[model samples]
Target: MKVHEIRELLNAKLYVGEGLLDKEIIGAYASDLMSDVLASNYLDEKAVLVSGLNNVQLIRTAEMLDLSVIVLVRGKTPHPEVVEMARENGIALMTTTLNMYNSCGILYAQGVKGFSNERAD
Candidate 1:
């Protein structure tokens, strides 16, 4: 699915990266824990990060992961700096009225698969 499609499906408000709406999303990662995101080997540039946590740290995490899209759940509004940072990093940031669980479910039903972390040990 594309970023714009997800935006429309979730009734999300786009805050940044209007030009990036054409980016393709191959998978999704939903988590409030930054550590979990950092540790996940399943993430790639094609994956979208979904979370309820709204902060600069979330933007930083997405940057570090080289993620192009982030969807903030539960209608949480990110701070000005957070939005600015996402804009600066060329990331597509959006917010949805749906909570994290429903957001994931909707995406899943739309054929958006979650990033699977299969332990090698």
Candidate 2:
């Protein structure tokens, strides 16, 4: 799906990178634990990170992992520094009022995949 498709499904607000709506989202990742995010084998070149952690580091993590979009679950807005970094790094940012679990559920229902609870060996 595309970024606009996600926005349409979630009724989310694009905090930054509004022009990035054309980007392809192959899957979604919902985790507050950045470690787990780092461990996942991401087949999706574009991932909509659904997390409650709103900070500049999250943006860095996203960049390091080559994630395309950051979806702030539970209405958690990123700080100005985070926004600046996201802009500088060309990362798209969005926020939704829905909690993490529900947001993940909705995205899953909409066909976002590539998550497994099992840990990497």
Candidate 3:
């Protein structure tokens, strides 16, 4: 799914990467634990992360993994530094009023798959 399609699907607000809304996302990874996300290794440049962590580290982790979009669930908004870092790293940032569970469900129902491939282990 495209970032814009997801934004519309979740009634999300886009905070960054307005020009990159058309970016394609092949899969979704929903997690608040940055360590788990890093270990999953399912996220690539084609994936989107739905997380509740509204911190600068989220941006760093996404940058390290080359993840394209970060969706802040439960209406959690990132700090200014986090947004700035995301913009600098060219990562799209979005926020949804729905909680993590609902957000994941909506995306999954829209045909977005989870990281079912081999784990980093």
Candidate 4:
């Protein structure tokens, strides 16, 4: 999936990196725990991170993991500095009203695979 496709799928508000809409999203990782996010194996691939934690460190984690987009679930919005940091790092940021679980489910149903260890099947 592409960044713009995710935005339309989740009815998300694009807060940064409008220019990054063309970026390919090869996977998705949904987690509020920064530690878990940092530990995920999906970092090797281009992915969209779905998290409820709307902090600057979340952006930092995304950067460290080489993620292309951060999806803030449950309508959570990041601070201005978080947005700025994302823009500087070339990461796209978006938000949705759905909670973490719902967000993950929707994305999963849309052919977005989860991290290797996160797969239930």
Candidate 5:
């Protein structure tokens, strides 16, 4: 579903990249460590990285990885710089008070799939 579709479907609060509300998202990942995410090699263009840490680095990493959205878990809000970074990269940003697990569950229930094609090395 598109980011705006996600917002409407998930009732998410958009903090940045409002212009990209219609951008589609194919999958989601719940993580706190940016390094782990990088290592995972997300493998989806419209992937949403749901994390708890709200900082500039998160935005930088999201941009670097060409992610579609960053969902802040545990209600953590990103700084203005982070928002601007998302805007610059056209990556949508949002947050939810729901814990990571709950958020992931909700997204899944709403038809957002988790990382597929994952295999043990």
Candidate 6:
């Protein structure tokens, strides 16, 4: 799915990177814990990070992971610096009224796969 498509599906408001709307989102990773995101190997694929924690660290994490898009859940508004950081890094930032779980579910149902660290246990 493209960034714009996800925005429409989640009823999100774009806060930055309006030009990045056409970016392809092959997968998704929803977590408030930046550590969990940093440790995931599945992020090698092009994906979007979904979280309710609206902060600069979230943008930093996405930058480190080379993620091009971020969806803030539960209608959380990012701080100005967070938005600036995203803008600086050219990452598409958006907010959705949906909670983290529902946000992930909506993306998943649309065929967006989730990042996983499971080992087939």
Clashes of 1: 0
TM-score of 6: 0.93
Question: In model 2, which runs have C-alpha deviations exceeding 4 angstroms?
Answer: 116-121
Q: Candidate 5's residue-wise lDDT over 1-121, tens digit each? A: 7777766655678887777777777888777888877776744667888888888888777877878788887877678888888888878888778888888888899888887446442
**Better by lDDT, candidate 6 or 2:** 6
Off by over 4 Å in 6: 118-121
lDDT, residue 60, model 4: 90
Of 2 and 3, the candidate ahead on lDDT is 3
Candidate 5: clashing pairs of residues: 4-21
Better model by lDDT, 5 or 6? 6
Q: Between 1 and 4, whose lDDT is larger?
A: 1
lDDT of each residue in 1-121, candidate 6, tens digit only: 9999999999999999999998787888889999999998668537889998888999899898888899999988889999999999989999999999999999999999886776352
As for TM-score, the candidate ahead, 1 or 4, is 1
1-121 in candidate 2: lDDT tens per residue?
8998888787788888888999988778888888888877742447788889898878878888888788888887778898899899988888888888888888888888745554363
| Deviation (Å) of 24 in candidate 5 | 1.7
- What CA root-mean-square deviation does each model show from the true structure? 1.8, 2.5, 2.0, 2.3, 2.3, 2.0
Better of 4 and 6 by TM-score: 6
* Candidates' C-alpha lDDT: 0.93, 0.81, 0.89, 0.86, 0.79, 0.90
What local lDDT score does residue 53 receive in model 1, on the 0 to 100 scale? 83
- True-structure lDDT of candidate 1: 0.93
Best by TM-score: 1
TM-score of each model, paired residue for residue: 0.96, 0.89, 0.94, 0.91, 0.87, 0.93
Question: Which prediction has the highest lDDT against the true structure?
Answer: 1
* Candidate 1 local lDDT, 1-121, one digit each (tens): 9999999999999999899899999999999999999998779899999998889999999999899899999999889999999999999999999999999999999999998776342
Clashing pairs in 1: none
**Error in Å for residue 101 of model 2:** 0.9
Query: Candidate 4 at 58: error in angstroms?
Result: 0.2
